[model samples]
Target chain A: MKLLLRLKFLGTDFCGWQYQPNARTVQGTLTAAAREVFGTDCRITGCSRTDSGVHANDFAATLELPFADCPIPCARIPAAFAMRLPPDVSVTAASPVADDFHPRYTVLTKEYVYQILVSPVPDPFLYGRVWHYPKKLLPDAAARMNAVAAELVGRQDFASFMAAGSKITDTVRTVSDCRVQREGDLIILTIAADGFLYNMVRIIAGTLLLAGAGKLDRVGMRRIIDAKDRAAAGATAPPEGLYLNRVTYHE
Target chain B: MKLLLRLKFLGTDFCGWQYQPNARTVQGTLTAAAREVFGTDCRITGCSRTDSGVHANDFAATLELPFADCPIPCARIPAAFAMRLPPDVSVTAASPVADDFHPRYTVLTKEYVYQILVSPVPDPFLYGRVWHYPKKLLPDAAARMNAVAAELVGRQDFASFMAAGSKITDTVRTVSDCRVQREGDLIILTIAADGFLYNMVRIIAGTLLLAGAGKLDRVGMRRIIDAKDRAAAGATAPPEGLYLNRVTYHE
Candidate 1:
C-alpha cells in the first residue's frame, strides 16, 4: 500500500530534502527512521528537493510499504515513526493513497513564503530564522514590489529566474499569485505557482528586494523576464529565509 | 565609570543567570567575554537571577571597567563585546550610567511575559521558546485567567506564590499589572510589578493555567493568597515559558 505523509522540518542540521549517500539529509534521516519501523524494503519518494537550510511548513512525500497489509494503522504511523526521528524532523500526518499516486507529478499549485527581518540591530531571538537585512526597506518598497510582482503572473518563460546548471529545458510556468507585505518588523513575500524552476523562488525574492531597494522598476522587471537569461535576473536569496508553505493537489 | 548594558539571550544553554562554581552560567559566560574585552579585573553584576532555561529580552547589567579611563567608547562597547560572546547571548546596547545607579535596587517596576503554545502536536520551530500544552483551554479560559490575574494586583504579602527555599523574609510585593491575552496559537501572560518574590511569576502562571483548565476558580485564587503559604498556590510553571520582557526604573 502507498502512504502519503506530510512533513515539517527545521532544515538547520540537514543538507537538504533529497537523499545523499553519506551526508546527513532530511530524506536520509526519514528513510532511516522508516527502515527502523518497517524494515529496509520500504520505498520513499519526496515531492521536491529543497536547498540546504530551507524550511518547510508543509511538505509531501509518498512511501511504499512492502507488506501486503501492514500492521501499523495509518493514523498511528506518524506518532510511531516520530519516536525514531530526530527533533529537527517529524512526520506530522500520514494516510493511505492510490498505489500509483505521485506527490510531485500530480498537477496543482505550490506556495512559498520568504521572510526578511528589517532591523537596524540584530534580533537575537530570530537570528537564523530570517534574513536579517540591516538596511531599511524603502518607505514605498512594498507597493513597488507588489506592482512588479503583479506583472509576473500568468504563463511565461521563467528562464531568467532559474539558477545555473539546471538540466530542465521546459522553462514555461504559471505564477498564480505574487505579493509582498510587512508585518511589524518582518517583510513577508508569498508566491504561488503551478511549478517552480530551480531556485526560482529565491531569485524572485532577490528581484523583489532589488525593487524595494530602488534598483529595479516595473518596466525593468518586465524587461528581465523577457531577456530569457539567468544573468538578467537578480541574485538568489539565501535558503534560510525560504519556506515551502503549502502544496495543493487537484481534487 | 559604571556602564549599563542591555542584554538578550536564548537561554537554551547555561545553568542560569547567576555564577556557579563549575557550572555553565550566563553570568560566567558574560564575565569571561568581558575579561576578553576589558581584562580579568572588570566586575560584572546582573540585575536579577533567572532560573535555568528562562529567556530575557531586556535584561540589565552593570559593569565596572578596571581602567580609570577606558579606551573603548560607549557606542563601540556592544560591538566589541559581542565579538567575544556567543550568538545566543548578545550585548545589544551599552551606555555610561550614574556612579551610584544599581540594576536590582531603585527599580520602579518590572514586566515579564510568559508564552504557552496551546496545540496537541509540538511545533519544531518553537520547541524551546514556548510551553506546549496539549489540552484544549476552556472556552472562557482567558476571561477566567484574567479574573484571577486581577486579584493578584495591588500591594500584598505574596508568600503563597513564593518558592519554598527562598531566604528573603520580606514577601510584600506590589503588582501593578497582570493580564492575559491570546495571539494565534499562543497564550501570553504579562505581569508588571514593583518587586517579585522567588518564582512568583512562575507560580502565578501555574495558577492561571489551572484556572484556564477549570481546575481552579476565582474564590480559590483569593483563598490561596490569603493562606500565606507557598503550598497553597498551584505548582510553578517551567522556566522555558517565562521571559524577562522589561525592567523599568524611576527617572
Candidate 2:
C-alpha cells in the first residue's frame, strides 16, 4: 500500500531535501525515520527538493509499505514517525493513496513564499526564518513589486530568472499567481506556478527586491524576460527567506 | 555616563536572566558584551528577571559607564553590542539616559504574554514558543478564562499564585489588565501589571488552563486569591510558553 505524508521542517540543520552521501539532508533523515517505522526495505520519495536553510510549512512525500497488514493505523502514522524524527522535523498527517499516485507527477500548482524583514531592529526569534534587509524600501514599493510580479503570469519561458548550471533545456512553465505584500515588519512575496526551474523562485525574489529598492522597474522586468539570459536578472536571494507553502494535487 | 538599551533575546540557551556563577545566563552574557563595549568596570542593571527558556520581545536595561570618553558613540552602541552578543541576543536600541533613571524602579507597567497551541498536530516552528495542549478545551473556554483572569485585576495580595522560596515579604501587587483571546491555533493570555511575584504569571496561566479544561472556574479563582496560600493555585506552567512582551514607563 502507498502512503501519503504531509511534513514540516525548519530546514536550518539540513543540507537540502535530497539524500546526499556524508551530509545531513531532510530526505536522508525522513528515510531513516521511515526505515525505523516501516522496516529497512521501505521506499520513500519526496515531492519537491529544497535548498539548504529553506523552510517548508507544508511538504508532501510518498512511502510504499511492503506489508499489507501493517499494524500502524493511518492516523497513528504521524505519531509513530514523530517518535523517530528529530524535533526540527514533524510528520503532520498520513493517509493511504492509490497505487499509481505519485507525489511529484500529480499535475497541480505549487506555492512558495519569501519573507524579508525591513526593521532596523533585528529579531532574534526570526533569526533563521527571514532575510533581514535593514534598508528602507522606496515608498509604495510593495505595489510596484506586485505590478512587476504580475508580468510573470501565464505560460512563458523564464530562462532569465533561472539560476545557471542546470542541464535541463526547457525553461517554459505556467505561472498562475504572484503577489507581493507587507505584513507588519515583513515583506512577503508569494508565487504559485505549475512548475519551477532550478532556483527560479529565489531569483524572482531577488529581482523583486531590486524593484522595491527602485533600482529596477516593471519595464526592466519585461526586458529581462525578453533577454532570456540568466545574467540579465538580479542575484539569487538566500534560501533562508524561502518557504515551500503548499502543493496541491489534482486527485 | 548612563545609557539605556532596549534588548531582545530568545532565552532558549540561557539559565535565566540573573547572573550566576558557572552558569549561562542572559545577565552574564549581556554584562560580558557590555564590558566589551564600555570597559570592564561598567555596571549593568536589567529591568526584569525572566525564568529559564522564557523569551523577551522588549526588555529594558541600564548601563553605567565608568569612562566618560568611551570610544563607542551613542548611536553606534547597539551595533557594537550586536558584534559582541550572540545571534539569539540583540540590543535593538541604545540611548542616553538621566543619571537618576532606573530600569526597574522607574517602570510603570509590564506586559507578559503566554501562548498555548490548541491543535492536535504539533507545529515544529512553534515548538519552543507555545504550550502544546492537544486536548480540546470546553466551548466558550476563552471567555471563562477571561472572566477568571478579570479577578486578578486591581490591587491584591497574590500570595497564592506566587512561587515559594522568595525572601521578599510583600506580595501585594496591582494588575491593570488581563485578557484571553484566540488567534487561529493559539490562545494568547496577555496580562499587564505594576508588579509580578515570583512565578506569578506562570501560575495564573496554569490556573487558566484548568479553567479552560472545565476543571476550574471564576469562583475557584476568587477563592485562590482569598486563601493567600502558595499551594492554593494550580501548578506553574512551563517557562518556554511565556514571553515578556513589553515594559512601559512614564517619562
Candidate 3:
C-alpha cells in the first residue's frame, strides 16, 4: 500500500527533508515514525527538498509500505508521529494513496510564499520565522519589483536564477503565476510554479526585492535572466522568508 | 527623559517578566539592554508580569532614564534596545512619557488569554505556544462558559478560584469581562480585570474551562467560589496556553 501525507513545518530546526548520513532530517524523522506505525520500512518520497529555516504550510509526501493488520487513522498518524518526531517537524495529515500516485511527478501546481517583515523595529516573536527589513518600501515599489518577477513567468531558461550548484542539469522551468501583495506589515510573495530548480524560487524573490528597494531595475533583472549565468543574478534571499505553501498532486 | 514602550513577547523561552536571582527574566533582559542604550543602570516596570511559557501581544513598560543626552538618535532607541533584547521580546513602539508615571499603577486593565489548541494532532510549530487537547469539545461550549463566567462579574470573592498562595489578603476582585470564544482551531479564554494575583488568572481559566467542557455546572462553580476555598477550584491550567494579551494604561 502507498500513503500520502500533508504536512506543515517551521523548517528552522531541521536540515531539510531528504535523509542525510548523520544529520536530523525531516524525512528521516517521518520515515522512522512511519516504520514504527506501519511495522515495516518503506521508501518515502517528498515533493520538495526545502532548505533549513524555510517554512511550509502544505508539504506533500508519499510512502510505499506494507503493514500488518489494518489502516491507521489519518488524524491518529500525525499524533503518533508527532510524539516521536522533534518539535519543529510534524506530520499534519496522512491518508492512504494509490500505488501509482507520485508525490511529485503527478503534481498539478506548486505554490510558494515568501514573507517580508518590513518594520523599523524588528518583530522579536518573528525573528527566526520572518525576514526583517528595517527600510520602508512603498507598496507600489514592491509591486514594481514583483512586476520584474512576473516577466519570468511562462517556460524559460532559469540558469541565471539557479544557485551556484550544478546539482540538476535541467535549468528550465515555468512560473504559472506570480504576485506580490501586502497584508498589514507583511509583504507576501506568492508564486505558483509548474517546476522549480535548485534555489530558483528564492533567487527570483531576491532579484525582485532588489528592484523593489530601488537597487535594481526591471530591465536589469531581464538582462540578467537573458544572460543565463549564475553570476548574473542577484543575491539569494534568506531561507527564512521562503515557504513551500502547497504541493498539488493531480487526482 | 522617561521612555514608555509597548512590547510583545513569546514568553516560553524566559522566566517571568520580573528579574529572578539566577534565571533569565524578561525584565533582566530589558534592564541589560536599557543600560547599553542609555549608558546607565535603569529600572523597567512592566504593567503585567507574565509567567514562563506564557506569551504577550500587548504590554507597556517604563524605561527610566536620564536621556538628556548629547548624541545617540532617540527615535532609534527602541530599535537599538531591541538589538540587545532576546528574539522572543520586541519593543513595538517607544515614546517619551511623563516622569511621574508608573506602568503598573497607571494600568487601567489587563487582559489574559488562554489558547487551547483543540485537535487530535498537535501542531509542531506551535509547540510550547499552545496547549493541545486531543479530544474535540463541542461547539457552543465556549458560549455556555461565557454565560457561566458572567455570574462572577463585578466584585466578588474569588478566593475559591485562586491558587493556594494568593497573597492579596482581600480575595474580592472585579472581572470586567470574561469571554470564551473559539477562533479557528483555538479556544480563546479571555478575562479582563483591574489586576490579578500570581496564578489567579490561570486558576480562573482552568475552572472556566471545566465549565466549558460540561465537567462543572454554573451552580457548582458558584458554590465553589462562595466556599472561598482554593481546593474547590479546578487545577491550574498549563502555562503554555496563558498569555498576557493586553494591558491598558491610563493617560
Candidate 4:
C-alpha cells in the first residue's frame, strides 16, 4: 500500500532530508524506523529536499510498503512510528494514498517562513531556532521589508534570488504571496510559491534583511530582480532561520 | 559596585539555578563567566531558585565584585560576559544598584508562566519546552481553567500546593493575578505573586490541568485550597513547562 505521511522535525541535528551513508539525515532516520516497524525495507520519498538545519512544520512524504496491506490502522501509524523515531522527529499524520500518487508532483503551493531575532542580546530560548541579528533594526524595518517583498509577487524569473552553480535551467516560478511582519523582537518573512530553486528562499530572506537594515530599498530590489544575476542579490541567509511551513495540494 | 543583572536561559541542560560542585547549573555557568569577565572571585545571588529543566525568560540576579570599582561600563557588561557564557545562557541587561539592594528581598511581584501543549501528537519544535498532553481537552478548557484560576488570586495559606518536605512554615503569599489563555494548541497559565513556595506553581498548574480536562471545577479547586494539606492537591507538574517570566522590583 502507498501511504501519505505528514511529518515535522527540528532540523538542528540533522544533516539534511536526503540519505547519506555516514551522516545522520532525516530520510535515513525515518527509513530505519520504517524498517523496524514494517520488518522489511521500504521506499520513502520526500516532497522537498531541505538543507541542513532547515526545520519543517508540515512536510509531506509518501511511503511504499512491500506488502499489499498495512497491519496497523491508518490513524495508528504515527504512534507505531513514534516508538522507533527520535524525539526530534515526529510523524503527525498518516493515511492511504492512491497507488500512483506522487508526493512532490501533486503539490499546489509551498510556503516557507524565515525568522529573525532583532535584539542587542541573544535569547537563549531561541538559540538554534532563529538568526540572531545583534544590531538593532530600524524603527520601520518591517514596513521597509514588506515594501520590497511585494515587488516579487506573481510569475517571474527569479534567477537573481537563486543560488550560484545551479545546474537547473528553469528559473521561472510563480510567487503567490510574500509578506513581512514583526512581533516583539522577532521579524518574520513568509513566502509562498509554486516551486523554489536552490537556496531561493534564503536569498530572498537575505535581501529582505538588507531592506530591514535600511540598506536596500524598493528600487534596489527591482534592479536586482531585473539583473537576473545571483551576485546582484543579497547573500544567502542561514539555514537555521528557515522553515518549510506548509504544503497545499490541489483539490 | 553592585550590579543588577537581568538574564535568560534555556534550562533543558542545566541542574537548576543553584551552584553545585560537579553538576552543570545556571548559577555555576554564570559564576564562571562572571569570574572570567571580572578577573576575580565574586559573589552571585539569584532572585529565585529554579528546578532542573525550568526555563527563565527574565530572571534577576545581583553581582558583587571583590573590588570597589569596575573598569568596563555597566552597559557593556552583558557583552563582556557573553564571550564567556554558553549559547544557552545570556545576560540581557546590567545596571548599577545600591550596595545593600538584595535580589531576593525586593518588595515587588514575580510572574511565572506554565505552558501546556494540548494536542494528540507532540510537536517537535516545542520539544523540551512544554508539557505535552496527549489527550484532547474540553472545547472550553481555557475558560474552565480560568474560572478555577481566579480562585487563587488573594492572600491565602497555600499549604495544599506546597511541597511536602518544605521546611518553611509561612505558606501564605499574596497572589496578584492568575489567568489562563489559549493560543492555538498552547494553553498558557500566567500567575503573579509576592513570592512562591516550593513547587507551588507546579502543583497549581497540575490542578488546573485537571480542570481543563473537565475532571475538576471551581468547587474542587476551592476544596483543595481549604484543605491546607499537601495531599489534597494534584500531582506536581513537570518542571520543563514552568518559566520565570518576569521580576519587578520596587523603584
Candidate 5:
C-alpha cells in the first residue's frame, strides 16, 4: 500500500530534494524515516527535485507502506518520526493513496514563488529565504514584467528561458499564471505551470529580474521570448530565492 | 574616537554573540567586518552573551573605530560591513553614541520572544527558528496564560522565576508587558523588562508554557512567583526559540 504525503521544508541544509546516493537529501531523509517506521524502502518518490537551497510550502512524495496488519503504532508515526528527525525536516501530513496514485505524474499545475528583497537594507531575518537584491527595482517594472508574463500564460516554446541541453523535448508547457506583486521590501514572482524544464524557472526569473532591474526592457523581453534560444535569455537567477509554493492535483 | 552600533543576528551559524578569546563569535564577525571596512581592529561589545542557537532581532553592540580619521566611505559603513559579514549577521543600523555607552550597562530595557509550534507535524521552514511543541496545549491556555502574565506585570520581585545561581542582589525587575499571541500555527511569547537575570526570560517562558500545556495551574503560577526560589520554577526553555527582540537605552 502506497501513501502520498504532502510536505513542506526549508531546503537550505539539503542538497536539493532528491535522493542522491549517500547524500543528505530531503527525499533521502524521508526515505530513511519511512524505512525506520515501516521497515522498508521499496517505493518512495518525490513530486519534484527542488534545487539546492530552495524552499517549499507544499511538496509531495509517495511511499509504499503496508497498512494491512501494521505491527507498529501507526497513529504515533508522525510524532515518532519527528523525534528522530532534525529541526530542518518535518512531515506535515500522511494519508493512504490509491495504489496507482503518483506524486509527480499527477495531472495538475505547480506554483512557485521567487522572492526578491528590494530594500536599502537587506532583511537580516529573511536572509536565506529571500533574494537580497536591495538595489531598487525600476518604477513600473512590476507592471511591465506582468505584461511580459501574460504572453507566457498559454502554451508556448519556452526553450529560450530554459537551461541548455535539457533532455525534455517538450517546451510547450502552459504557464497558467504569472503575476508579480510588491509588498514593502519584497517582490514576489508567482509562476504556475503544467510542467517546467531544467532551470526553466530560474532562467525565466532571471529574464524577468533583468526587466525589473531595468537591465532588459520590454522590447528585450519580447526579443528573448521570440528568439527561442537559451542564450538570448538573461543569467539564471540563484536557487535560494526560489520556492516550491504548491503542487495541485485532482482526485 | 569610536563608533557604537546596535545590531541583531540569527545565532544558528555563530558560536555566540560575545567575543571569546579564540572563537568565531558574532562579535568576532562584526569586529572583522568593521576592520575590513574601517581598517582598524574595532573592539565590538555586545549587550548579552547569547547562547549558541539563540537569536536576536535587536542585539545591542558597540563598535570602537577611529571615527576621527574615518574614511570618506565611512558613511557607507553599514552596507560595506554587511557585504563582508555572513548572511546570518547584519548591521541593522549604525550611529555614533557616547564614548561611555556600553551596550550591556547603558541599556535600560530589553524585549525578548520565545516561539512554540503546537502542531502534529513540525514546520521544516521554521525548524531552526522556532521550537516545535507538537503537544496539544490546554483549551483555554491562551487566555489563561495572558491573565497570569498580566498579574506579573509592573514592579515585582521575580526571584522565583529567575534561574538559580545568580549573584545579582536585586531580583526585582519591572516587567512592562508580557503577551501570548497566536498567528497561524505558531505561538509567540513576548516579554519586556527593565533587566533580566540569567535565564530569567527562558524560565518564565517555560513556566508559562506549563500553564499553556495544563501541566501547571494558575495558582501554581502565583505560588512560583511568590516562592521567590529558583527551584520553584519550571524547566528553562531551549535557546533556539528565544530571540532578543530589542534593546532600549536609558536617558
Candidate 6:
C-alpha cells in the first residue's frame, strides 16, 4: 500500500533531504527506519529537497510498500517507525493514499518561515535555530520589510531571488502570500508559494533583512525582481534560519 | 568591581549550573571563560542550581573580581565574554552592582515554565526540549490543570512538592502566581514564586498533569499540599520540560 507520511525534523545535523552515500540525510535516516519497521525495502520519497541545516515543522512524504496487507495499521505506522528512527527525525502521521498520488507533484502551496534574532548578544536557546543579526534593527523594520515583501506576491519570474549558478531556466513561480512580522526580538518572514526556486525563500529573507536595515525599499525590491538576474538580488540567507512550516494538498 | 550577569543556557549537555570537578557544567564553563577574558580568578555565583537536562531562558549570577581596576567596560563585558563562552551558554547582559549584591538572596521572584507536548508522536524539533506525553489529553486539560494550580498560590508549606531526598527543613514558600495554558499541541505551566524548593516546580507540574488527565482534581491537589509529605504528591516531571524563564530582583 502507498502511504502518505507527515513528518518534522531539525535539519542541523542532516546534509539535506536527499540521500548521500556517506553523509547523513533525513531521507536516508527515514528510509532505513522504514525498512526496519516493514521488514522490506520500501521506496520512500519526500515532497521537497530541503537544504542542509533547514528545519521542517510540517513535511510530507510517501512510502510504497511491496505488499498490500502489512501487519501494522496505518495509525500505528508512526509508532512503529519511531522505534527505529533517530531523535532528530520523526514520522508524525501516516495514512493510506491512492497509488497515483505523488508526494512532490501534488497540487497545493508550501509555506516557509525565516527566523531572525535581532539582538546584540546571542541567545543560547536559539543558537542554531535562528539567524542572529547583531545590529539593532530599525524601529519600523517590520513595516519596511513587509512593504518590500508585498512586492513578492503573485506570479513572477524569480530568477533574481534564485541561488547563483542555478541551471533551471523556468524561474516563474506563483507566490500566494508573503509577510513580515516581529515578535519581541525575533523578526519572522513567512512566505507561501505554489512552487519555489532553489534558495528562493532564503534569498528573499536576506533581501528583507536588507530592507529592514534601511538598505533597500519596495521600489528597489521591485527593480531587483525585474532585473531577472541572480546577481541583482541580496545574498542567500543561511539555512539554519529557514523552516518549512506547512504543506497543503488538494483533496 | 562587582557585576551582575544575566544569562541563558541549553542545559541538555551540562551537569547543571554549579561547578563540578570533572563533569561539564555551566558554572565551570563560564568561570573558565571569565578567567580568559578577565585574566583573573573571578568568583561566579549563580542564583539557582538547576538539574541536569534543565534549561534556562533567564538566569542570574553575580561575579566578583578580586581586583576592581579591570580594563573592560561594563557594556562590553557581554561581548568580551561571548568571545570565550561556548555556544550552549551565553551571558546576555552584564551590569555594575553593589559589592554585596547577591543574585539568589536578593531576588524577589523567579518564573518557570514547564512544557508538555500533548501528541501521540514525538516531535523531532522539540526533542530534549519538552516532555512528550503520548496519551491523548482531555479537551479541557489546561482549564483542569489551572484549577489545581490556582490552589498553589500564597505562602504555604510545600514539603510535598519538594524532592524526596531533600534535607532542607524550611519548606514554606510564597507562590505569587501559577497558571496553565495550551498553545496548539503544547500545554504550558507557568509558575512564579519567591523561592522554590528542589524539584518543587517539577512535582507541581506532575501533579497538574494528573489533574489534566482526570486522575486528580483541585481537592486532591490541596490534600497533597496539606499532607506536607513528598510521597503524597505526584512524581517529579522530567527536567527537560522545565525552563528557568524569568528572574526578578528586589530594587
User: Highest DockQ: which candidate?
Assistant: 6
Per-residue error at A58 for model 6, in Å? 1.4
Per-model C-alpha lDDT, please?
0.87, 0.88, 0.81, 0.92, 0.80, 0.92
lDDT (10s digit) by residue, model 5, range A1-251: 77667778888889998889977888888877877776666467889888889988988888777565445454666676787677677767667778888888884999999988876567667877888886767887777677666666788888898788878777878889998887877778999998888888888877888778667765777788889899999889888899998888878
Question: Which should have the higher lDDT, number 4 or number 6?
Answer: 4
lDDT by residue for model 2 over B80-133, one digit each (tens)? 876788878889888888889999999999999999888766788998888877
TM-score of each: 0.89, 0.95, 0.93, 0.95, 0.93, 0.95
> Which runs in model 5 stand beyond 4 Å of their true positions?
A66-76, A119-124, A139-144, A217-219, B67-69, B72-75
Candidate 5 per-residue lDDT, tens place, B1-251, comes to 55657676887777887777777788888877877876767788888888888898888787776666556354566677777888788776777777888888887889999998878778877766888777798777776677667767889899987667778878899989898887787778899988887888888878888878767766787788888998999889888898999998986
lDDT of 6 at B148: 89
- Candidate 1, residues A31-139: lDDT per residue as tens digits? 8899998876678898899989999999999989877776788777876776688877878888888888899998499999999887655667877778878677788
In angstroms, the error of model 3 at A72 is 2.6
The stretch of ten residues in a row with the least summed lDDT in candidate 2 chain B is B66-75
RMSD to the true structure for each prediction, in A, is 2.9, 2.0, 2.3, 1.9, 2.4, 1.9
RMSD to native, candidate 5: 2.4
TM-score for chain A in each prediction = 0.96, 0.97, 0.91, 0.98, 0.92, 0.98
lDDT string, candidate 1, B8-35, tens digits: 9888786889999999888988889988
Higher lDDT: candidate 1 or 3?
1
| Model 5 residue B101 lDDT score | 82
Candidate 3 reaches a DockQ of: 0.67
Model 1: pairs clashing at backbone N, Cα or C within 3 Å: none
Query: Candidate 4 chain A — worst ten consecutive residues by lDDT sum?
Result: A119-128
